[model samples]
Target: MKRTLVFGDIHGGLKALIQLLEKIDYSKNDRFIFLGDYVDGWSESKQLIDFLIELSQKQECIFIKGNHDAWCQEWLENDVVNDIWFLHGGKSTIESYKGIDSSHKEKHLEFFNEMKDYFVDENNNLFIHAGFSSMHGPEKEHYKTNYSWDRTLWEMALTMDERIQKDSLLYPKRLLLFNEIYIGHTPTLHYNVEIPMQGCNVWNIDTGAGFYGKLSCIDIESKEFWQSDVLQTLYPNEKGRNK
Candidate 1:
């Protein structure tokens, strides 16, 4: 049977990632998909990226760009944007490369730039970094831009109801017939009461691994879910209290 394992946000948790991979029992025939946010929050961003690069060279691996990743690439491309980049989880990412040299930094940026916006299988299983705009339903054409940083379309779609009209609608040929999509970016209900519907059909696998939640992954063909234990606390609990 053809198997594709889709991993959720890493957030620089190399140990957790390694544990999850062990559980999956990776094989030569199976394909692996990373849904982005490979850095930040945890302390192993550089190691995780290096491991991903090595894996990509050996087996089939799909990478999607996340918001944090976008910032990393921007900071690496130009030094002028350092302030803005550091504000968005770039601090931890930079710290991950403390001992590395200029050559390694260039390679890291190259890898980040090469990541794809989305990955689709023969069965039409769509894997995107972040959730798609509800305005476009699950169509591919609506996902032309990098969703990692684009919020205009998403913000508009969030306010509207969920409905795909045949007429006066933009639907991509690739997703017009697909049954499901797998994505990251938006956290699940575990983090917030009003879970964003923009991630709905997007099969959110993020699960806020680096926050007050657990890491998640799923088998596209089986719809079977797997999650790692909550790594640590990220914020105060409800009622304005700390845990």
Candidate 2:
């Protein structure tokens, strides 16, 4: 019996991720959709990716690209490390693999290269790191990268009056076409919640594990969720959101 599970941004909280997995009692038959930002923040970005790569071999997995991952890809492909990346936790990622072997580095790059901008399951449930164009679907000519960087989709969900019927012409057609949308770029903690949040048909699962919150994983079908300890506790030596 394979189960579908979606994880929020990791941001190098390897210990948090591990604890969350254990809490869920993960099995090989599970299908996982990781909502990106696996690297950055904590100090084990490299190790976290390595574990994810190995996990893929034992279970079904879909890795969605996040904004942080885009920065990582840019750095890996062109050796371009922007100040924004470091400011947003790239410094720790870089330090994590300071003396890592080139071969291992290549493997991580390959994993990052293969990540998807967004994924729509057979049931039309959309999974993306960030949001997408509300006016158009992924088929639009806009930069596809926006699938992992856009926020309007979530913003609309956050602001809309749920009681009012969603009019296709008045709402994002993209959202209308899906049964549900799952996003991770915006931490739910910002909304004062430490758990996956549902607004309209969109689910915000990034519970700020990258900062002072916890890592969350939820079952798409059952809505059951598991979370790690406060990330700051996982990395007592590091300044998480405080940084």
Candidate 3:
């Protein structure tokens, strides 16, 4: 049977990602939904994008845009580099492109530009890089940046009382808009866990590849998941985002 796989924030851990795919025994029949932040963490950001481009040619892929991706996209498009992006792992991303020329950068830039802020499957399963704030839904989100930057939605889910049933008036209206929501951006490490986390109807798959955690993926239907070696071990000499 074909699989619908959802991957969390990669943060440039190319080796971890490769290990994860091999562990899962990836096939062309698998449908991949990658929650972005593909760049700005480790040394292989450029190579990671190259691999994704090639993979897309052979398999179905849906790439969601994350805040880091948005920042990298701007740099690629206009040569802009701000301090926040720099301190947060953008420097490694820039260094990764040392020998690359304009043509290659342009292709990668196009890849980043084509990424979607969010994707919704027929089952009303929402896939996005981050949370949406609007009570109506992501499509109706007024601050479009919320698609890649919002955290309040996840925060609300975390605070939800399990005893408070979904049908209750106290239930969050935003969570009701979708059957299930899958996202990345806020690392689970912040919550002191190195595994995928579920809060209400939302699943946070970003297991913190940008820091001490590992890269992760989930078989959305089965809820079975896989993870790579901790990124810090994979790139032992590098500090990653922990710096």
Candidate 4:
């Protein structure tokens, strides 16, 4: 079986990320999937992005845009969007690239632009940065933007049951369509736990790494998780404060 190493929501923890990679013993044959949010909450956003870019050049890596990444992309597109992006952890992202040249900013933007919204393997394992919409049929097939900010769809899926709810409006038919959906953005109580919901079809891997949470990774086939040690005081107390 192919081994895929999946991680996301780094929130700028360069040290923790390095440690985690060492534990994995990453190799040329393995594939890495990063679910986005490479910046924010911690201080190493720029470093992490740079490392990821370098890693992508040598090995297989798939990057998806997170909400934070979208903010950065918007800022890069126009200064008019700076205020909006800054409010959502773009401030830290800017700080991460302090003293860098315009070329660096362009590079980061290019990387973000190329990220995929979702990755589906031949086995039908779907990997998305955020959860999908709950609405069934055509809504599920809509482009990336629809899935990125659609919270209602995610809420419906999370609350839906596994048995006897087919085509029910209260629950989503889309959730039942995938072999497994691996997602970030919603943190789990424990970093090592996969937080299976809706009959183990959906796995939440965020582990709150940006908000007093640990960085986490999962072995997709085994459904086993690995995480950094807890660091309660790592994040700022101010609500939405950029670290």
Scored by lDDT, the top model is 3
Please give, for residues 1-243, the per-residue lDDT of candidate 3 as tens digits: 888999999998999999999999978898999999999888999999999999999999999999999998888888889789999999999998888888998899889989999999989999998898989999999999999999999999998889999889999999999999999999999999999999998999999999989999999889999999999899989989886
Give a tens-digit lDDT track for model 4, residues 65-182.
Answer: 8877777777667744467667666677777778977898789879989988878888878888776653452235565565455444445556555674655665446766777777
Task: Residues 148-173, candidate 2: write the lDDT tens digits.
Answer: 78888888888886666776456656
- What C-alpha lDDT does candidate 4 achieve relative to the native structure? 0.69
lDDT of 1 by residue, 90-124 (tens): 66777777888889889998999899877768876
RMSD of 1: 5.3
| Model 2 stretches astray by more than 4 angstroms | 167-169
Which window of ten consecutive residues has the lowest lDDT sum in model 3? 74-83
RMSD of each: 5.3, 1.4, 0.8, 3.7
Comparison by lDDT, 1 against 3, better one: 3
Q: Tell me the spans in candidate 4 whose CA falls farther than 4 Å from its real position.
A: 134-144, 162-171, 189-200, 231-243
The per-residue C-alpha lDDT of model 3 at residue 88 equals 97
Number of the candidate with higher lDDT, 1 or 2 = 2
Error of 3 at 73 (Å): 0.7
